[model samples]
Target: MTNGFCSDDFAPVKEAFDRNFKELGEVGASVCLTVDGDTKVDLWGGIADPKTGDLWEEDTASIVFSCTKAATALCAHILIDRGALDPAQRVAHYWPEFAKNGKENTTVQMMLNHESAVPAFRDPVRPGGFLDWDYMVARIEDEDAWWEPGTRNGYHMVNFGWTVGELVRRVSGRSLGQFFADEVAGPTGADFWIGVPDNFAKPLAPILPYAAKPGDELSEFSATLLAEPQSLQALSFLNHGGWNMNDPAAHRAEIGGAGGIANARGQVAWYTALATNDGRLVSPEYLATMTRVSVATSRDATLLVPSRFASGFMKSMDNRAHRQGNQASAIIGDSAFGHVGAGGSIGFADPECGLAFSYTMNQMGQGILLNERGQSLIDAAYKVLGFANNRSGAWCR
Candidate 1:
């Protein structure tokens, strides 16, 4: 069921990957890891489409949902590193229209840190509005801030693509997708795409939604999504203009917050540059700023769970004991920074250990964060690196 290579020292990761298929119901997935800028594990297996029984190949790409945020954030940071954008500056300094509706004080950092107070649309989005970049940008510009911009934080969820992505477009004079292609993916040779092109030849894996058992409980965020359709939790995730996530059109649309398409190898390759500080992406100083925790809260407005975020990326967040239904946690090295997708997909750079790790799968998992299948692999990697435990919410030596 599994195929690929694993370094001798990282054999445990391969075992964990296999166990995901045997025990955790992983459908189609790929996991890749790099340490000290060396490829340590690259594996993929299972059926790409259960309906057709097609096999997952070496280059099969799947929608990696919110993991795209890391790529989007990296593009913005590149512009920041080049003096083309400033994080601390008011966002209106670049996109003048964003200042309207109590957002005059919204800084670029606020947008990246999820403190922009525009986490979701209060009104319903028009059909297919998410696919229209201009339409979404205009909507965000015209919408009122939910609260004072800098007072607190909420997971921006889907709107993150447009909010920070617009800044990338305005300041860099290029669309977010193009900027990522030209600057990040192209230079690093990562086979990830913000907007998949028509000629994309690799086999695409269709996502299989998670199925809940009879006794499965709902997370607080899930309960809110069900009970309060107008709440930020629901609006952020459910107000997406009724776009079919698995459709080809959605793949072509550049929804940077949740529409990235890639395999595990592509994510690991991209993160390797950052993990090694290889000078291809950003300076070490800027990388430090990007990885440092920017905001943390016991209860996220959207997710309704403990959360920690860096600028445009997620830090190690252990919510195992914080809730009853979904005890999901993204427990990586303390210094690691990355984003978890809507399901189980994850990608991160642990600079402390010179490791870049990623796991991508077509089968959606039951949680807003890393599920057991993905976390098990992470645990194995950390153990091989001699990390003691994730006792303090993050793995440490």
Candidate 2:
């Protein structure tokens, strides 16, 4: 088929795909774009299989790492809009046991902002720790926090999905994954899926090998923002038995932060719905709240950097790599928000432009976290919208 994007308009996008596939050893990759709520770019190339070199198809779903957190948080925001859960309410109100260990005062907003200090399980996290939903919650219930909740923002690490999911379950009486499907994915008909189901495993492309070597370039980025010098190498996100793509039973696993899997279509749809106020998933008012920066400026205990949190979502306190653009990636617009997966995959929306952009890839870059390829596409989008290199450190609401 002819390239969906105009040749001139798609130059940077095509370049990004080609450079990654060739120079960066990218195996399978896909990118999607919706402008003014219309799909302007839906393109995939490169091989999905390393063994036989099978090409990436239109329906390839890869595990979109932290990008899943946004979807999970979206579930919570849905209920918040419906008045089922209050961000400011004490978490104990929803799940009484959560009040143990001086946590009675912790609010749902605190947990979502990564301010709850439940980064790791405070216990060993193994494969099925994901399955033992109750044990996981119990652990959080009994343990003292690493820091005071709501004092600062930190990456929830492995515990974000569980913490948020548990609160969601108590409020909605459905597992995090189920609530997401019933309230978010199913209604939107987007390709994004959390807690992978058995039947859908066939279409997924397992994560390609990357994080093994630091190759010297990313050492600074690794040390500064990641809280560890060898973070990129020690980052074992791809280690789950089938972290690549999960089967049915695995779909219910509480990976609110990581287990989200999606093709380009799903990512685009999420932003499409988010931008246009497509009902049944998340309302426009709630969507606005999701990016409201619930936590203010401070050094995060886990991420060890300054950040702003919007309930269970993340916003930029400063211009970081993913926040790359004229104004800053995170500060693109008041309504611009989405999340990036661990590897090179990224998805987000800018309602101001009526645009949603996504890029998925198998090859993981050695950069600290954000991939240059994905950022390039976003920069091009900014150029198309006439805000190519903003530095005002402000977002137009």
Candidate 3:
């Protein structure tokens, strides 16, 4: 049976959550949603550790991969609201070293919108070198742009955290971890963290390594481009070696793009603050800029798919290229903005619905986007809000 509570209006979400473990292959997971600052659903179940059969608990948390990008984007918005950062200013103005390799023209806004053109380093990266922030930042600073700056958009993948994190550090004079803790999580009381503290670090659920089933089961995208050694997709994800989410060092290191650690409740609380414009993180004026569509639709250079982005979050769009087999594509109303993690995890805020939802799990799914397990819950949530029937491209303003 699924554990935790749900409001009567949200009982369908819990039903879907339970079906995930019974019918789908959910190992360990949590799903939470908040509407207009009130949490309506919270649930968790299944085995966090198959070896020991440890049941997932209320406090259990795990890596949410690229979901961290949303948190990093919030950090940038905080700086923007404070007038400490100007999105229009050159990134080099804050971090002078970033000006090297013909990147002097790249603006901080471009970095946020995935248009900065330095998605990954061309040189070989050491496996654990990401643990050293200075090294990563220096490498990115010295690396040349993969395309002309500000002309196109591409998923920054691994480099996003370092690039955004370094900008946060340079401008705020605090590490991204420290800044997030003092500014965002501390104020909102969310248990999420960019660098999971040493005290709350251990006994975290680990992401199950992805394994393909028999007989050409891997998607053509995964097989052809993401698996190819020299392709940008492979290099971006594998350059730092296979990340072990359970490692203590991984918890301590602030890989803001890929290393955010949080539970479903934590994400819900954080996004609730965003959805309600509560001013706990940033002012509502800046929140509009943060959540609004910044870049129009485009074909991502590295991901080889149509992607629409705003600041640091993905937009809900009707790109048919992104719709096929994309369980994680914008199923939420078009006005929503949030980021999905590498595996199945997804967290987003729909201001129009005053809804914030998060799903986190230890079992990694094969899809690049949200898997069936998470999508089922989202569908149930929107149905309750009377917007399941309104998911056309026009839902976004």
Top TM-score hit: 1
Flag regions of model 2 displaced more than 4 Å: 1-11, 211-252, 316-334, 393-397
Candidate 2 lDDT over residue span 295-325, tens digit each: 7664556544455666766553344533222
Local accuracy of candidate 1 as per-residue lDDT tens digits, 301-391: 7788878899999999888786652345888999999999978899999899999999999999888898898999999999999999988
Error of 1 at 99 (Å): 0.8
Assess every candidate by TM-score.
0.98, 0.85, 0.95
TM-score ranking, best first? 1, 3, 2
Q: Where does the lowest 10-residue lDDT sum fall in candidate 1? A: 320-329
Better by TM-score, candidate 3 or 1: 1
Per-model CA lDDT versus the true structure: 0.91, 0.67, 0.83
Residue-pair clashes per candidate: 0, 9, 1
Residue-level lDDT tens digits of model 3 in 110-161: 9998888888776788777877788888899888888888999888987899
Q: After superposing candidate 1 on the true structure, give the runs of residues whose Cα lies further than 4 Å from its correct spot.
A: none
lDDT of 3: 0.83
